[model samples]
Target chain A: MKTFRILGRNIRDSFRGVWRNLSLSLASISCITITLIVVSIAMILSANVNNFTSQIEKDVTIVVFLDQNIEEDDIDSLYYDIDTIQYVESITFKGKDEIAGEMMEASETYDSIMSNWTHEDNPLQDTYLVKVTDIDHIAEVAKEIGYLENVSVVKYGEGMVEELVSIFDMIKNVTIVIVIALILVTAFLIANTIKITIDSRRREIEIMRLVGASNINIKIPFIFEGLVLGVIGSIIPIIITCYGYAALYTRLHGQLFSSIIKLIVPEPFMYNVSLLLLVIGMVVGMVGSLRAVKKYLKI
Target chain B: MDQIRVQGVTHTYKSGVTALYDLDLTVEKGEFVFIIGSTGCGKSTLGKLLYRELKPTKGTILVGGINVGKIPNRKVYKIRRKMGVVFQDYKLLDKLTVYENVAFALEIFGLPKDEIHEKVVKALELVGLKNKLKMYPRELSGGEQQRVAIARAIVNGPKLLICDEPTGNLDPKTSMEVMTVLDEINKLGTTILMVTHDINIVDKMKKRTVLLNAGRVLKDYAEGEYTK
Candidate 1:
């Protein structure tokens, strides 16, 4: 009970300290708010970039067109050969009839041009759609499929898919690095701001010591002050993360520029980001205050 | 019983300047003793050693029967709680009001809120600042600020009070007022060890005066027996 009472008083003193040192508290709070806002933005971008990278990984596939002279048995053998290749996850055969049907349904122009083409006279060739276990090895899998007999053409967007995947990977990596650096910088900034605040109250701390305040008694309020500052500082960024991300998702219609680049759904994503911001704010605030108070308590 | 017992205490600063050399002193409970010396005579060093602020180079100090010199820095607050210290500067926190200033002493001990309030009010009343409880330190006169410092010091009901030049910055009249307050506190059974350069106050009050010169006790005078 006595410990609880002391804790309660320390908490009150921290709140009072914040209220009394309004300018210093504001400086620290604003420092956290601005840094957290930037961190949230970096986190959101990084998360979306990762999502897009995975989506691309799933969507990319190898398309191997067979020669027009190939027989049905030859096609089945070719399919088996392709299936036996390393990293080949799955293979699906699409005959010329199915290909013509899909092209015709895609547009009236293709349908008019191909409506009279009989199956025997069809210019379209049968194709095998291939998926690989690893997107990075898609090129190797495609090359192996191209060497197969009766395979006339193998296409998987050639250079474009690799470049796009690499770019997405780089984007994800850069944003991650940036997010981490920003969090570290934010913690440093909060530590300095709280240090200035504590420096201004060195006399008060000395007086507390002279009056026989235990180290814990002297430290509790300042640490609590930091906690309060951190929590308060995170409020604006959290609001922005929760409502801003949701609004951005709604405004962009859940994707950016086109469907190929997608944004994460805001429901749980924004909540998770907001929770992270809150935790960072709180932990940084407390640790920063603790460090500053420790220096002065040595007296 | 002796409230303070210093035996062969010697203090050397980090710069190798020996401030006190083999000094021995004792003060019984409820006694008032004045420690007077020249500017560099190590009077302040003795006060600091007694409070465990400055560890002695060679000796032991017992305040309230605890071996204070050997107490670790972290646990020094336990010894400090049994004594109060007043500085010449009257180190009252400018941000806290008079009431809060005194109450801060009890608050550190985690006393009950009601008891803290009662003690704070009583201490302030004794210092004649109960009516000025809400006023800030800057709003008070120098002597009043020193009284607030006194109130804060004695709020813990410390058996011994170590005052280092409590009136060094005050005018003659104000110093006497502050001295009167100290006298009243000492009369109420708190042993006071005051270090001062005010010969007039010392000669007039005529308490037991221990005179020092160059880190050595020059004279130990009884009541009404000290001279310039």
Candidate 2:
């Protein structure tokens, strides 16, 4: 009962204080909203990058080119042997004529320049396009395919795969650093604002103490005030995030990644991202208010 | 029984200025005592010492048997709960209404809403400001503001109330009326330790008076008339 009464008083007082600081409070809330929006954008960007990378990893494959002189039976058993590899997601066997046809189509522009190309004389060789369960196991899978009988060469974009891994790693590190810096900035801004407000109310606080107000009673309102500010601030960024992502997708629909890659950050991802922003907003507000109140209330 | 006891208490400020010299005094429960002295003679300091606002530099002082000088910092709130201190400035919160100021004490004590409303109305009535409950302190006259302060001081049902020249900012007539309100509250059994320079009111009251000069207790008398 006593605790409820105290909480009631804090609620009343917090509203009163917020009213008194109508302009400053609104300004602070706006700041919170804008900062939170930027934070949300960063979060969404990082999420999308993660989603895009994972999708690419799942679809990426290994291409094992074969010797032109390799026999049909050898090629047939080579596909069977490649399928035996535990890490292989699937295997696609391309014939010599199919490979030469694909090359001819690819080099169609060269036809106008060279004007002399035939499928029979095409240099492209048959290959096994192998998709692996784990991109991390790509090298081992490729090596096993290379050792197969009559396998002339093993060809996959191994360098591109490694580069993609490094890119994801670098992005992860940068995103973490940016988030830490943003959080620190938010905390500092909250602390300074609370400190100023505390200075203005110092004498009033002293009077409240004399009148028998408990320390918690005096502090709760200020903490709540900060929390409100933080919550309101985080919302602005969240709304902007949804709108911004929608705008990006509208422009990038057919221009950037393939339809499969486009499927990665669909509507559901945005929905979850909004929920993530809500959680971040709540925690930031709670933490900012707690910190500000603890530092200045001296309770 | 003596509700407050002070012995050989001395105090020095952080700036190294001596605010109080060896001082000793006592007041019984249900007593209305006037602490009289000149401007810089430690009368306010004594009141502060009694309330644990400022710790005594030496010797022991006790209020309701709580050694105020040795009270831990956090538990200072505990000591404050048992007592109320008023200032010459009528330290009612400007932001809070007259009723809220009085009810603030009850609120801090965690009294229920209905109980808070009851006590606040009762305290305001005691101070004769029942009609002005909704008015802010800034809208109140000096005498009315002081009455609000007195109302706040007593709303917690404190055993002790310290009035440090609460009437200093008021006119003579207003001061007398304010003192009358305090006297009325005292009649309900709250011990009051009042520090004042008004010899006229002090002499007329004929209460227990402790006269301090140069930070020391110059005289203590029962039913004493005030002179300087």
Candidate 3:
């Protein structure tokens, strides 16, 4: 009960402090809001890029065309060999007849051209579609599979896959740097803002110290002030990120260059992002106030 | 019992300025002692040492039997709770009213609201400013503001009250009014250690006087003693 009463008083004083210095508090809140907005935007971009990269990775598969004159019994051994490769996730066999049928069904022109073709006359070769666990390791896996006996040709979108991987890597690195820089800048701005408040209240703190107020008693209010500022600063950015992300997701859900690429779904994605923004805001606010109050609280 | 005991206490600032050097003084419980000194005579430094504001560089200070110089950082507040300190420039929060200012001292201890109110009212009543409870610091006169500061200091019923030039900012008449409040508080058995440059008040009060000159005690006298 005593602790609660102290907390109540601290919170009350924090609000009083905030109200007493409205312009400075507003500046702090604005700084946090702007910083969090940039942070959230970066997070959303990273999430989307991650989603796009994974979709592209899923579409990457090496097609191994078998020699037509190869014995049928060797197919099982070939499948087993490809499956044993470390990076290969799965390998599915497609007979020549099945490939011809799929091609004929996919296009009317192909259907007309191959309408009269029978199983014996089909031109397609038996193939293995190899899926790798990681896009970066796909080239290595495909190269190893190319040397397999009875494998006539091995093909994967090597150029496009390498370019996508590098692009995603660059994006990830830049996002980390940007997020770290933003956090430091936010902490600096917020700390300086809280420092101004502390400067104004220096006499009040001195009196509190002289009058036997415990360090915690004097510090709790400023901590509460920082927390309140952080929460207020994050609210607008959270709202904007949520609604804005949902809108962007709706507009660009399946509209990427390739049908296989996609944006992350809005519900869980925005929920997690909102939670992240709030937590970051709170931590940044607290840390900023803690650092700012250290010098003034020597008493 | 000795309310304050300073034994060879020497205080040096971080900038290598020694404010107090081998200064030894003692004040008994309920005694009103005036620490009269010119500027930079180490009078204010001694007052700060009593409140554990500055630890002595070389000597020990015992306030109410506790070694104040060695009091840990966490226990500093506990030591301060037993004493009240008033400053030259009445350090009252401008945003707070007179009533709130006095209550602030008790509020810090997390006293019950009603109890805080009663104590604040009584303290203000002692200072004869109970009628100006609603007035802000800026709204009150210089002497009235100092009275509020005294009320704040004494509201917790501290055993010792350290006033570092409480009347420095007041006129002769106003200073007398503030001094009367301190005297009244001192009469109630709260030992008062007042550091001041105003020889008029010190000579008029004729309390036990300890003269500090250049970080050392020049003279110590009982009541009714006067010095030029």
Best by TM-score: 3
The segments of candidate 1 whose C-alpha lies over 4 angstroms from its true place after superposition are: A64-97, A107-134, A140-155
Off by over 4 Å in 3: A70-73, A251-261, B14-17
Residue-wise C-alpha lDDT for candidate 2, range B79-123, written one tens digit per residue = 888897888998777878998888777877677889889988988
Q: How does chain B score by TM in each prediction? A: 0.98, 0.95, 0.98
What is the C-alpha lDDT profile of model 1 across A203-289, one tens digit per residue? 988888888888888888998899999999999999999989999999999999998888999989999999999999989999998
RMSD of each: 3.1, 4.5, 2.2
Ranked by TM-score, the better of candidates 2 and 3 is 3
* Highest lDDT against the true fold, candidate: 1
TM for every model, in the order presented, reads 0.90, 0.84, 0.94
Which portions of model 2 show Cα errors greater than 4 Å? A66-151, A158-168, A251-266, A295-299
Residue A229, candidate 2: Cα error in Å is: 1.8
Q: What is the interface RMSD, in angstroms, for predicted model 3?
A: 1.7
Candidate with better lDDT, 2 vs 3:
3
Order of candidate numbers by DockQ, starting with the best:
3, 1, 2
